[model samples]
Target: MRADRLVSLVLLLRQRGRLSAATLARELEVSTRTVLRDIEALSAAGVPVYAERGRHGGFALLPGFQTELTGLNHDEALALLVAGSRRGAQVFGLGSALASAMLKVVDALPESYRNTAAGAAQRLLIDPETDLLARRSVAEEVPDTIVAEVRRAVFAGHKLRIRYAAADQAPKWRTVDPIGLVTARDQGYLLATRSGADRTYRLSRISAAQELAEPAQRPERVDLDRAWQERSARFRTGGDQVTVSVRVDPARRAHLVDTALTIGAEEPEVDGWLRLEAVFQDPRHAEWAVWQLATHAEVLAPQWLRASLRERATTLATRYDVPPGESRPSRASAAATSAATRTPDSTAPSK
Candidate 1:
C-alpha cells in the first residue's frame, strides 16, 4: 500500500505539478510525517521534488524538470497521440492536452528523429465516425444530468421518486430504490424495485426524478452484470423449446452450421437439399433468426411452428394480393380469414 501511495504521489506530481502535504497524506490515508519521508525518497532518487516551508508550502518538483520521453518508440507514440484525436476525445477533453504533450515529445526528439516522427504522424489518422454525444444518445433517453442523479442514487443506496412512462400505458408515479444502471446500445436503463418487485425503466422515459435525503437499506453488495446476464438467459428460456426438423436449401445450410443457435443432425432431402434437426427456444426468435436465411431453411417439426410460419406467410402473401392464375395465390388470398369467417368455397376446413 505504501509503494502504491508513492507511485500515486509521483504520478500526481507529474500531472498536477504540486499538492499540499496535508492533502497528499489525506489522499494516501497516511500521516504528514510519512508523506515528508516519501518526498525525501523521491528527491534522493534525482526526482527534483522539493517542499516549500510557509503559507504556500507544498511539495513540488524543481522548476523545468520533465520526464524524458525516450521510453516509447515511434509507432507506439504515434498510436497514443492519434488515439487522442479520435471522435470521442471531446468527451474526455483530451484533444488539446494530447496536442501539447505531442509537441513536448517533438521538442525533445533528436533532429534526425523529429522529421521522421512528423511524417509518421501525417500518415496516421484517427477519424471517429460517431461522436461521443451521438453514441451516448443511443444508451438512454434522458439527459446527462438525469443519469448523474440516478447514478448518485444508485451509488448512495437511496430511494428515488420518479415519474415514469411505459409503452402505451399511462404515465405512473412511483418510489423505487435504485439498484444500478444498465447500459444497452448506448442508452441507460434503471433497474430498480418498488415493494420488493424488480422493474426496468428506460432512462429516456424518466421525468422529474429526485433522490431522498435518507438512504434505503440494501445488500452490502450487488453484482449488476451477473444479474443482467442471468436475466437475459432466462428470457431466452421463457419461450417454449421444441425439437424441430427442417430442410434447408444448399446455399443456406452452411450458414446454419456456422450460427450460434443449436443445429441437430442433417439428412438428405428432396432435390439435393438437406434436412436439419434442431431445438430453438422461442418461436418469435426462431422466426426472426430463420428469416435471415429465408430461402435457405424449411421448418419440419413439432407441427405448430410450421403452422405459425404458414399463417405468417399467408398474411404477407395476402398483402400483395398475388394473382389467382399465377404461381401465387390471388391478391385477395392474402385477406385474413379464420373458421369463424371462412366462406363455404374456401378450402380452409372448419374447426
Candidate 2:
C-alpha cells in the first residue's frame, strides 16, 4: 500500500504540476501529516520537491524533473505501446494529449524496446482491403465535446446538466447523475439517474451537456452495464406479443421462411398455397413482418390486424400514386423503397 501510494502521489504531481497538502492527502488516502512527511522524504533525497503557502498556496516541483523507468521485457513494452497508441488519439478529450505523452514514454524507453515497438507499428497495416464499410446511419451525431463532458462527470461521480430532446417534447434541461456512457450498434446511450429513476438518453438527442458543481455520491450497488443490457433486451423483446397466421404459396413461403425476398402478400397466395405463423411485439411491426411474407403468406388471425394491413396497403398505394385495383410494386421495386427509408451514413458521429 505504501508503494502504491507513493507511485500514485508521484504520478499525480506529474499530472497536476502542483497540489495542496489537503488535496494530496484526500487523493492519496492519507493524512495531511503523512503527505508532509512524504514530501520531506522526497526533498531530502534531492527530488526537487518544493512547497509554498499563503494565498498562492500548495506544493510544486521545479521543472525538468526526470523519473527513471526500468525492467520491462520486449513483449511487455510492445503491449504497452499498442495500448497507449489505441488510447492516445483514438478517443476524445484526453486522447490526443495522452498520445503525445506516450511518445515521450517511447522515447524514454531503452533502444531495444523502442526499435521493437517502432518496427511493429510500421509492419502492421490496419487499412481495409475493400470499401465495404457503409457510412454511419445514426439519426443524429453526438458531439465529441458533449461526450467528453459526460465522461468527465461520470468518472468523477458528479452530476451533469443536459439539454435532452424527447420524442414528444421540446429540448429541456435536466440534472442527471451520470453512471456511464454506452455505444450500441448504431447509437450512443448515456445511463444516468434523475428523480430517483434510472434513465437512458440517446447521446445524439443530448444537444448540450455541462458539469454541475454539486457532487452527488453514486450508489455502490448499481452496475450500469448490467442494468442497461437488461433494459435494452426488454425493449427488443417485450412489445405486444402476438401470433399471426397467414396462408401463401408454398414455394414463396419456403423462400420467405428461408431466403430474403420481398413480395406482395397476395402474390404468393396466388402462386402456391403455404400456411405459417409467427410472433410479434406490435401489430404494425408484426404486420411489416407479414408484409415481407407477402405473395407467400396471408394474415389468418386477429381480424383487426388484417384490416390494418389493408389500410396500410391503401396508404402505400396513395403515396406511390397508384390507382385502386392496381397491383403494388414487385420485390425489386420494394427493395428500392426500403433503401429510401434508410437513414444516411453522413448523419452519424465522427470517430
Q: Write candidate 1's Cα lDDT for 1-351 as tens digits.
A: 354456556655654567999888876557999999998887887788887778877998766676653343332343354454332222222333343344455656776886788789789755434566664332223554565577678868899888888866878888888887665544457778778777777877887688887776566688988877876676545656655677888887777666425776877876899888765666665666566676678877768777888777877766567566556534455344444486676776778
Q: Which candidate is the best by TM-score?
A: 2
Per-residue error for 8 in candidate 2, Å, reads 26
**TM-score (C-alpha) between model 1 and the true structure:** 0.46
lDDT of 2 by residue, 29-111 (tens): 57999998888877887778888878758888787666663233332343354353342223223333343344446656665
Q: How close is candidate 2 to the true structure, as a TM-score?
A: 0.47
Enumerate clash totals for all models, in the order shown. 11, 13
Shift of residue 14 alpha carbon in model 2, Å: 25
TM values, all candidates: 0.46, 0.47
lDDT of each: 0.66, 0.67
What's the C-alpha lDDT at position 311 in model 1? 79
